[model samples]
Target: MSDSTTLVYKKKKKKFKIFPLVNAIFFIIVACLIMIPIYRVIISSIDANTSYNFVWLPSKFTWGGYTAVLTRSSLYTPFLISVVTTIIGTFVGLLVVTLGGYVLIQWEMPGRNFFAYMLLFTMIFDGGMIPKYLVIKQLGLMNTLWAVILPMSINVYNLVLMRNFFEGIPESLFEAAQIDGCSPMGIFFKIVLPLSKAALASIGLMFAVSFWNDYTNFKLYITKNKLFNFQIQLRNMVIDSDIPVDDAVNQETIGNAATIIAILPFMIIYPFCQKYFVQGVNVGAVKE
Candidate 1:
């Protein structure tokens, strides 16, 4: 066919689908619904008024929430604690998972099947909270930040996903590395690690989120008020009603501020890692 005729045929073949267009509009509405509350909270942080309202644009804007939380409330120390723990936990957890996943995919490792079974076993079973508490107490981790970071550094589900991704890699690449006098560690760092960015970003973000939002662990294991994370303090104020009755300060406003502080890092981090997240989630979801 002539090029002009082919182009005309292709244009004729394209038809607008009402269902897809309607579906997209429906989801867009739902997305806006989900985002409205978050937008309100962000705006409320700078709003001077204590009462929540439906006003998209306030008559007067003030930095009262930010100022109150930062200057008066006990949020600063806990903010620092959360930042430190999240960074450390994410790095340590990623390293452990990446190497562990690489090893699980290796056919020559001794007791590889047995170890994989054991790892999978833990995913299905639980040690219970009492046993976990006892272990932490015995290790002198109580009231310490390590109490939270150590227990959940390696999530089994994330490890499994990482393994599935590594298994998808071509075995010939490993053989080529071996032929080039590359050690197992060298191959992992030089080849496997570089190629596994999607899985790493996905798992790393999971670890960071878990670490950042861990209030129950801190409440259970950490008694020292100074060591509490942002989530822990926020839980105390919002859930436990630990807010003191003070005429000068509004607890509700402070709670809203705390909510923003707790979730802002996640909001910022997701956009950067979202592309990798979608790809990584799909990598292990299908079987060829």
Candidate 2:
């Protein structure tokens, strides 16, 4: 290469490097800000003192808190409830959203746009707490796990994202499937779904996170202690000052452990889905 050309290429490479470095620094700062608070929560839970004093590390660490809370027969029950709810909610919710999105994009059903609009409207505006509660009560779903799962089965944003993805698929593929004697169901199960795996996995993770973190629905509808989700249980421990710490060995430590444990599942799952998550968000956010 000529000297001028080589110099220009070097300058461009340096400029590109600068931008990535700037982005890396920003990312690190944001990550540290987020991690610090979480670390403090973990620390506080393990700390012996109840005071809100700042500490970089726990003065003393003990697993007594974890054992005390976890050993209770009732404690494990809520964990079970949370796991079941998360799994069911994620699966059912993703299935419905994916199917619905596919139908909206591929099928020439009547009032499709209107229905899409309605779904989008719900995302924008809700019936508020009282009316939603009444609806749940009237349906006789209150105090059941169904209350948590049923209401949020289809997230409109995810539906729209999937719909967009489906729209992007070549119509020739569907036509070929039809010619091959494939029913709509067969096409969906065999072709469309397999092709849509990335989007599905992405939305599934989103649904899983939402269900895992939900506490309001459980708090309002679940009267049974055994039915409490992890978030609800965590909230009870954190908010209820009157709950006797002495009753549970090393209550502070246990609380910290629970806080860390509560978030650990999502932390583990996030990295796996992160690439798909970014792609999903970009594709889903694309306006039709």
Candidate 3:
């Protein structure tokens, strides 16, 4: 066929579908619903004379809220505690997850099934709050960051995902490494880890987000104000509801700014790990 005729034929063959158009419209509406509130919060943070009022756009804009939030000594304690706990918590959690997952993959290990079942059982049932509090008190972890950090590492859902990811590794690689006289640990370090970057990144991000946003654990275990995390303090600011009209900025603006600051790390980190997250979620979802 002539080029023009072929082009005409292709154009004729292309029939627009209503489903795709409708789907696009639906997602666009959903995106706007999500982004509009975030945009409003950003505007409110810089707004002068801010209140619990809706701020679609700031009529009077200034950075006073950010300045107050960043410079305030009272806010500094929680921010620092959160940063420290998040870093330590993510590291400890990732270590436990990786090691635990690796152990589950070792078929010949005695009591493997028993241990796995126990882990799943713990997921469904936990010691009641009183017993948990007593344990933390007895262990001398109360009023410390370790109280929050330790519990953050024991997520059974993440454990299950890690095991599935390890299981997805090709059996041939395991047999080949054994034939080469590579110790199990050597194989884990050299072969398994290099292939499991996506899973690691995904699970690490999960752990980081969990630890960073933790308020309940910190509230329950740590009575000391000095050990409180950013989320706990943020809640305080929101509840106080006293906006100082005399000041350049008010608690309302700072509260909104604080909320943004709390979530900003993941906002920066997630885009880098997004591909790995998608791949890891898929790779770890193996059929039994």
**Predictions in order: lDDT:** 0.82, 0.79, 0.85
Better of 1 and 3 by TM-score: 3
Q: Sort by lDDT, best first: what order?
A: 3, 1, 2
Q: How far is candidate 1 from the true structure (C-alpha RMSD, Å)?
A: 3.2
**Of the candidates shown, which would achieve the greatest TM-score relative to the real structure?**
3
Model 1 segments beyond 4 Å from truth? 1-7, 237-249, 285-288
Report how far off residue 186 is in candidate 2 (Å): 1.2
TM-score of 3: 0.88
Clashes of each: 0, 3, 0
* Root mean square deviation (Cα) for candidate 2: 3.2
**Order of quality (TM-score):** 3, 1, 2
* TM-score per candidate, chains pooled: 0.86, 0.85, 0.88
Q: What are the per-model C-alpha RMSD values against the true structure?
A: 3.2, 3.2, 3.2
8-75: candidate 2 lDDT, tens digit per residue: 99887843458888999999999999988887887777666634676897776655556556665555
lDDT tens readout by residue for model 1, 203-248: 8888999999887899889988899888877777666666553444
Worst 10 residues of 3 by lDDT: 238-247
Question: What TM-score should be assigned to candidate 1?
Answer: 0.86
